[model samples]
Target: MITVVTNVDLFSTFQHVLQPLTLKPLQVVLAYSGGLDSHVLLHLLARYQHLYPQHAYLAVHVHHGLSDNADAWLGHCQQTAAALGINFIAEKVVLNVGRRESLEAQARTARYQAIAKHLNNGSLLLLGQHLDDQLETFLLQLKRGAGVKGLSAMAAQMPFSLQENCLIVRPLLTHPQQMLVDYASQAQLSWVEDESNNDQSYDRNFLRHQIIPSLKLRWPGIAHAVHRSAELCAEQQALADEIAEIDVVTCAHSFSGLNIAGLAKLSKIRRNNVMRFWLAAQYLPMPSRHHLDKVWLEVVNAADDANPQLRWQAGEFRRYQGVLYNQQQYAALKDVVITLEHTLSQRITLPDNIGTLHLQDLIQDTIHNKSGVDSSNAIGDNDSGCCVKAPLAHDKVTIRFRGEGTCHPVGRSGSRSIKKLYQEYQVAPWLRDRIPLIYYGEALVCAVGLWVCKGYEAQAGLYWHVTRER
Candidate 1:
């Protein structure tokens, strides 16, 4: 059951919730919307700011260009914030909606992205989602038969952005819609009413205006009870996350991927749990259940040489030599060859701006057999040094991306084809041609980020060590 709350009582609640915030230094920014809920939140925050002057307070209004009154809303937010003596920032964002996609979802995504740009290392993005909104979210998730994570609905506090370290807090989660409206009326705050909110074509509006009101009439305490259930789901989700975390470390083949052998040992549900958690933690879009099933059946369980891949909107899952790879984007490769001069201190930029390279000093004593020589620890003794031939100005230092040659890298027992070496290094087939091969005259000398030919091994006394930095 919900209790009738006075504006004073609401202020007390807000003050109580904000106590934890003062322990650490944070830039507090309100996600302001010129609505009853947000207006009340803004008013209360403004009032509270005087008591806690140590914390920085700011407001950001996202202008999602869907409504004709968007400009007016922006104006209202700025004006109101000015009257309250608060700093205000307004951001305009374009919504790119697909023909069949939900315009609401796309607008929300665009709005959050625009807001995310303003948030940095230590930011607290205060949102104005109240109990009614939480109820609506829970109902919607239920209708769609969402799992624990989804059914947990919006938390009072949670990580806001996938790309940035920010926290979104809904301090008014327990504040009823009536309490906010009453506060707005008592304060005589001016707010613009968006006409789109009344359009029942939107699912939220339908639930808010048409469905939830009728349900509330019959069961007045439903919102509070549902919120309690959501809280319980949140606890359950946390426990599930703990199990997944332990399992992830066990299943990891390399740094980030699940070893198919380790993964196969888990039950199907556990595997799915880890996969979903892994994707979400890595900031990659989680595949739909259908797509996840396809990946499990086709890619993870496929033959060693199957080379199966699954792609969705934002990322792709690939299998490379018995390991799974989730790549956010394929690196753009360039075919253009670059000409560079060899100088000890000269750093050359590679073509297509792939990366930068330079001579990383020369070492004595270590004629690099299998790499891993510390140039910093180079010994100057002639007996320990492999004498290197300095590049003559007449010899053109040509850098080519792709070449057909049978060249031997220094200290390797036998000469292998470059194509074979690329495979041996497990370089992606599409990226092989993009690895720049360095040549002094017609002799293949080194492949940047790869190997130096045997003949071109750093000769003693100040032999050059090629270093590639991306």
Candidate 2:
């Protein structure tokens, strides 16, 4: 079995798995740790690259700085990759652990982000997680009473980003830890053994050192059986996703919201499934069973006139006026005011990475001619809010949030207070305070992106049009 774990089996596996990749162009990056598993991965990939020279093979090592010998491990990875003629890069990231976050999880999150920086639109990130690692994750999820998604464990292939363009492929997921050790031995390859792995205080380390060995002693094929069970869970998850896809199309009308009525029609199990897909689509954290139950009963089944909400560790969901809105409450956006420079077109980065504010000045006649024919070549939202006459040569323009009083909005009947208008428009409460109010001195000009005050409507000359993009 040790001899069978040679480079021959490794290369054969790579060839069989990557045959589809030759159809399109994409960079393959190995997540090298200079550990036994990853070292074997890099060694095999370096040899296989000789045959498939058409593909780019690179290795990335993230120096988490969690271990005392992290610097030494990074150096070894660089030297080994250089000797194999493989392009190597190293990134150092600090784990920002808040009061609620654990160091282990934070380090993993930071490490993945650091590595993802090097990947491009169609990159393939190869992870070195193997069968033994999968078993540890399975047991951990089981102990926590995780749902189907968690029980599925690590996938052989998965989208690494929300855009689904980049992929994370675990090529060694089927191979056992001992096979990697033997393969490294067969090629006389050397690697690091992290001291932290021996620390049983960590959940995975405890499972690896304390529980799994004893289980394997009783059932020799325990690892393989657990992996097979994980595969079955993944299949069930896929089927559930298919059901969610159909239901999501019915309830999911927009990117940021779902239709309340459509969701109410789904069965409890189906509703939870759709909710999971909806949250996952937006890259929000998945809530647990208890929180999800509260969301279904309170949020999904609330009265049409009632505003019901639920907050979990990841985010919050609210239902209002027959619509459901998903809010990432934990990701606090800066509540600061940004000035609008009227002198030129500019893009301003919003606080808390909300998105960018796009400001461009436009001319009224340039947008549409007096005869209803296209006239001036200026851009406009065809509304008074976006069609303000350009600022006077001496006017100092600015943008801010929160204001009071009444004004007739563009394309509305009668003047109304901003507060009443907010209720009339059925705007989400969270957004009412965050909307940017544009001002030209004492008089209100426009509610950026929402409405333009009546008196400030553009007539003929150039005006400012502001938009926000996420």
Candidate 3:
């Protein structure tokens, strides 16, 4: 058992010092599992909410539905939240702890994913992991032989770029488990002990029960020391990021995907860092060290004309026609076309553009900020609707597969081939095939948002619309 401290001054941490500059007036969601650590965190957040009423607070409990007592634990969590006068939400998710993933890691990923659903565009998701957890993570990274980034471990606060927007803030990284237990006892808060946590079958458990304790007995402050080492590594990582940003700009070209020619000029270490930075920017899974070596040999050393390809778990990368493209393989669009028979007067959302469709929905006041409007025509009084036809379904509107075509943009007198247009607009080849084209049953109405034919002009009073996005 770990020795406990009676009191914890939560406000003295590095985070509190940086709170003025860092903290946003956003919702704070805690991944509460009714476990010792999360329970302590939930209590701290409750206290924090009382202090800062401007920021919203919520406790999310994810029910994996794995344990027999899952429902009972959820009930306990609900009661605890009610007693604390904090909003509580629960989510149930299925976890398949297959051969590749341990039950602990699988459950962790699912639980956090569920908690992330409660977050909004500017919210903060706080986690309860402590110093010991950081040490374990460091050991795991070492076992996998990860480089500097992995060794840096988790950041104290970092923006999490999920579809459900928020930043994942780890405020408890500086604290140890004993400090949390001490705080819980002093605060008289009750929390459940997960039986699975003690099971030696899990790798983390084995490390916690068998290895860490033995190591701790020899060096009492091992976890803290390791935590310090991780901090230093983290600082080094920030420096690396600074250097990488500069290198990336120098070695990159807007036209040729990632300038493989420019990348070849840097030393091997700088080359690897630049590659990793670019991959991170694209959100592709970082390739293994060996894979990076392979890519370097292929991209930098191979003949300029050679097309090289590298693939990993998340996505694939290919070089073609002096431009390298990274793509996530997806199913091809169905050959079928679906049409809406709604009247033009009715506000109808087109099939593909989920965000925007009709002209009325467009922000009139914000029109000045937007570019690429047909400027030569009237002083923007009537936004072009393409054709002034009476409210009728007579216009053969169908979503068609992108095919070889010639486009005569509204202002341009002559037509240009699709391939040439793509080049002129600097649209990547992968994006060209992905752009949706609306067809008037053989005649291309518009390249969605790209360009509309000069022949099809929207006059003052009729109804027509088109939209597109990157």
Measured against the true structure, the TM-scores of the candidates, in listed sequence, are: 0.74, 0.77, 0.77
Candidate 1 residue pairs that clash: 365-384, 386-459, 386-460, 387-459, 387-460, 388-459, 388-460, 409-454, 410-453, 410-454
Tens-digit per-residue lDDT, 1-470, candidate 2: 01234554776776677767656656889989899888888887887677677788899999998889999999999999999878999999987656468788888887788888888888888888999999999999999898888899999999886323788888888888887777777789989999998999999999998999999999989999999999999999999999999998899753257787898898889988898898887777778867888876888787767778787776678876667777764333234556655445566665544445555444433444332222243334443225565666566666666667888887788989988877776667676665556666656777665667776666554344333322
Estimate candidate 3's alpha-carbon lDDT, on a 0 to 1 scale: 0.68
Kindly list the per-residue Cα lDDT of model 3 for residues 1-470, writing each as its tens digit: 11224557654452383366336677778888899888877776666666677777789999998889899999999999877778999999998756576677788778767876778887777788888899888888888888878888877878776634567778888787888877788778899878888888877888888988888899999888888888888888889889889998877654225776677779989888888887787656578888888776775456877666677676667765455556556445546454646433334443333223443212231354343334334222323334332323457665554557687877777989978977765566665655555566577766544566666545442333443221
| lDDT (Cα) of model 2 | 0.75
Best by lDDT: 2
Candidate 1 regions with alpha-carbon error over 4 angstroms: 1-8, 97-99, 303-305, 327-470
Clashes of each: 10, 4, 3
Is candidate 1 or 3 superior in lDDT?
1
* Candidate 1 residue-wise lDDT at 434: 59
On the 0 to 100 scale, the lDDT of residue 320 in model 2 is 66
Candidate 2 regions exceeding 4 Å error are 1-8, 96-98, 162-164, 253-255, 298-309, 330-411, 414-421, 433-470
Could you tell which candidate, 1 or 2, scores higher by lDDT?
2
